[model samples]
Target: MVPGLPLKNTQASTGDTFEAAVLAGLSRRPRAIPAKFLYDAQGSALFDAICELPEYYLTRTEITILRDRAPEIAALAGPGRQLIEFGSGSSVKTRLLLDSLEAVAAYVPIDISGEHLEATSRRLRADYPALAIVPVCADYTDLPMLPWLPGSSGAAKLGFFPGSTIGNLDPDEALAFLRNARRLLGPGGALVLGADLKKDPGMLHAAYNDSAGVTAAFSLNLLARMNRELGASFDLEGFAHEAFYNPAAGRIEIYIRSLRPQSVRIAGQRFFFDAGERVHTEYSYKYDLADMDALAVPAGFVRTQTWTDPGRLFSVNYFVAT
Candidate 1:
């Protein structure tokens, strides 16, 4: 578990438990909030907008790779497979796989935002009327178990984790997540993983710090969420979104920085911020093929194939669980 963040208590509702986390995170030095808190309904919508930005090459590049490779991916997945997607946002890229896969037994899309998941599932149901579409609304990292899908018995679990969301987690957390996924996927399972490749710092900077400020809104929305759910008095305008590439770390670090000295109240508790103090919100780590293997191999996944665009900006890898 990340410092100051408590383990998910299965008994408590997500909203009920968020207050404690918000308070604990704010109380710590070099304050940081879990990135998952940034995915409330509004935040999720803002992120969808981010994907459409011209500066954001990740979405389009990965989509192109998935579009081009879906057939080949399907061939490896074989028939009667149950597709399980982690962090299935709008599931825009999933359509390609659904269309190409032969006789897919079921499709399970797990997401943190319930409203967004429901909306996406409805749209998918309409389009794939014959397919069994199960939408799980929970954090994929702490998901307890998947609902049993009827008629999916003996179907291979083909896990799809796209958009390089794995970058959001620290190395240890990423490894833990992959290990959990391997267990959830069970024997004869596989994962179609997308990862953003290490590249020019200029390009990386532009991707996260878009001129349109959609990414800014997406990052700041975390504060807005605290205000709404935890009765926190956060001045949204008082803080600015900061994102830059950390070359030494080989990742993009994002923070919500305090513009001036201020005090904020959350759940009747007060906290002060110094001028220019930053509260870390997210980290998007870039990876090379070797880095990916080093991370995934220890988690019990063997890389079978990898595909990248001509620019080599992003990678889509096919890994089978051992």
Candidate 2:
């Protein structure tokens, strides 16, 4: 039952992804799983909850920037363009852009979580019935060449990567993604990106380690997911979530630390953890304006403009592919 057109999932690639995660990747010196794996249906829902917590300022700050400057952002994106969003979770902020981009031809959202992506796309369809909603379930980092979408050919392509997701990638991977985006969007394309600014370490720590425990649940969901999907034996109670800022690295790192000496078996392979041992889950690198602008130049993009909230906690940058 192949899902046609508007709802498509790259099954082969996703299967390979699972194989890698279960067979070899899980049994590493310091076990780590790519953050993409953390967004299965349940994980995605938990993250949505995390965004609503009072401690999480990143989501609201970026939304404010978009709400206030949408027209200006839309103008730079140009009219009659296709809006292709990478890692378009929930698409909560996407509505602002969609409402402002009067001549937008179509909306293409790419996400790794197939079920969650489809659900979000369905909701968007109901709200924006007149618009074409193309949802693709695929990795944004290594995107397959985009097909020529209807009503999208002649119009400029506008790449929307909000959520400061670029921060999740290290500098090298982020540059590579931007460069690949350069090729995907072609010379006439523009990218609207959100980046979290470097701020007080306390604020950074609080954002990831929210008081409501949603962030912790999101981290633990990864383990629960492994137990369900990979046939792993992980005691959800045996590990604790920890997130903190690494000033030297300019990133916030999240880990699941073992509470005591423990062993878990995934796909029939055993891995042991000493007390206090941790498996790295995610890294979110904060960026200042200058550092972020420099990242674009090497990737063949020109940082034409930026919009930020009054608090300056976040930035939405407009980059033109050259």
Candidate 3:
């Protein structure tokens, strides 16, 4: 359980703002909510289940690539550097990197979930007794400025951002995020990024709308979160998960469609919806190799290398300051 923090009353700034914006956006048309909100405690658990679904190939494919290339990545990255992971949820795929990077001096995992971070960090420290685990309880986007390392004359710091989470942001936002990271990492640092590549609509659709219903449950968990945290009276059965890949947009759009006319109150406001209405929940933008370069180029970084799985379902890209 989350200690010292009230998970029952906890709320995320981005998730809260995005939810209201999405609710308003739905008034104009059927829409999807941002995927970030799905990280609440319950949503996070459901996503863990999604990773096990056969149709959800993203996690497995990325893990395979990481395992296959971790040695090479570790060798090229050298030793005694800080390994900071953004959105370090569960640290499921992170073990590969930690195990491969024998030269790492310290491991820093940052996330919005203080409870989750502390728990994962504690477990990692226990499992990897040799590693120094410095867990930071904060949002990845606004992580506090890091202190300079002791006895190091500006050594390179590596940034590990896996799980295709970059797809959560739009192009400009992605670029800005890269810039922000550049500022935090300074020169000579590197960024290892994972991204989903554009693929067939059938595969994309199946990945987000798995047969096991894990994805649907993950999508709906956001409502349950709101009900618990924001005093929301949402009828979970009145909303259904809907997901599809837009080929032209090169994105996956996930939404919760209303099953019947309903009225719900959240944060003291009443929201009414007609049958068949929907709220935009998430847009996961896919990227090609070139598009990934475009995102990093203007942010003062140059793509160093990219590793792809056999099916090209996912990419692990390495970038360095230009």
Candidate 4:
């Protein structure tokens, strides 16, 4: 059955052209582009393959932490609250949250990819027939206002932000995101966030640059997306995927470096790059407990509890709305 407006996932703008969106994003960061764009239907499928690669330990580590501590986190979430998730790509880690928060009446998954989001939501709805599924095909950074959960008279909300997607945002952007979340959640809501912590550079580099070459494929797929959607001529073979942890920057930078001097034309825009020059694709920032808490507190949240893997490679933090 189609959900009512109050329960339906709100889409900000479905008709917005993806090509125009990508171009504007490229202009914003001449050195890098948002990896979120790489999740076009095919790109999203490729990324699922990437997470399964043995070298990518972030997914595994986070899953372990969630599975072991979800019950406790759910208890903290309380009962009969709406579950709102941002950047809900695939939402694999969400199972732990939902399983723990059995009192939740709704599940909202927000994503930039319409096709992928719809498909995943449909499957999830089938599996969890008891829960209301609201999949929003909109950018998480600019989510539209949503209604309160059923059976609640403006009761408090619970936000589930899993997968350490927070690492993608820089310090300032991360702070802004936290502030925005705080505002949307209001005073009584709670936020459960997964964060990737600082770790060894070698481990970080390997997770991004895997042996099966899936990560490389995931990075290059952005160009493939452009070529297909924007009538651009990007020689996917002329570039190599390069990713490494920049310790100085406290982040992992993924770039598609030109194998040799190359000129790529996109949507009638011509750009030239010298040999070894690269177009940055993503930055996965790693933070410590103190750094994350410092960013969270000013945003009107007080850390309630944190669950981490034995290795301390990732942490799931529960914050009460202030």
- TM-score, per-candidate, Cα-based: 0.96, 0.96, 0.89, 0.92
Tell me the spans in candidate 4 whose CA falls farther than 4 Å from its real position.
1-17, 24-30, 147-153
Residue 194 local lDDT, model 4: 88
- Residue 53 error for model 1, in Å? 0.5
Q: Model 2: per-residue lDDT, tens digit, 1-322? A: 0122477675576746865774565577777888888999999999998888899999989998999999998777767888889999999999999999977788889999999999998898888877877888889998867766764577778999999999999999999999999898886999999999999999999999888788999999988988888788999999999999999999999999899999888776788889999888889999998988789999999999988888889999999988
Candidate 1, residue 68: lDDT: 96
- 179, model 4: CA deviation in Å? 0.8
Quantify all predictions' global Cα lDDT against the true fold.
Answer: 0.90, 0.87, 0.79, 0.80
lDDT of 1 by residue, 1-322 (tens): 0011111223347786577778888899989989988998999999999999999999999999999999999999998898999999899999999999998888889888888888888888878878888788778987777767776867889999999999999999999999999998999999999999999999999999999999999998999999899888899999999999999998999999999999999888999999999999899999999999999999999999999999999999999998
Candidate 2 weakest lDDT stretch, 10 residues: 1-10
Off by over 4 Å in 1: 1-11
User: Which whole-number lDDT from 0 to 100 does residue 249 have in model 3?
Assistant: 79
Per-candidate Cα RMSD to the true structure, in Å, reads 5.3, 2.4, 4.1, 2.4
Answer with 2 or 3, whichever has the higher TM-score: 2
Enumerate residue pairs that collide in model 1. none
Per lDDT, what order, best first?
1, 2, 4, 3
State the lDDT of candidate 3 residue by residue for 1-322, as single tens digits.
1112112212346456646854665455544555666786667677778888999899999999999999988887888677878888889888998888766766677776666667776778778876656676555765547543444435578899998989988788788888888887777788999999998889898999888888888888888888887778999989999988888879998888899999998777777888988787778899999999888999988998999987888999999877
lDDT of 1: 0.90
Off by over 4 Å in 3: 1-33, 147-153
Clashes of each: 0, 0, 7, 0
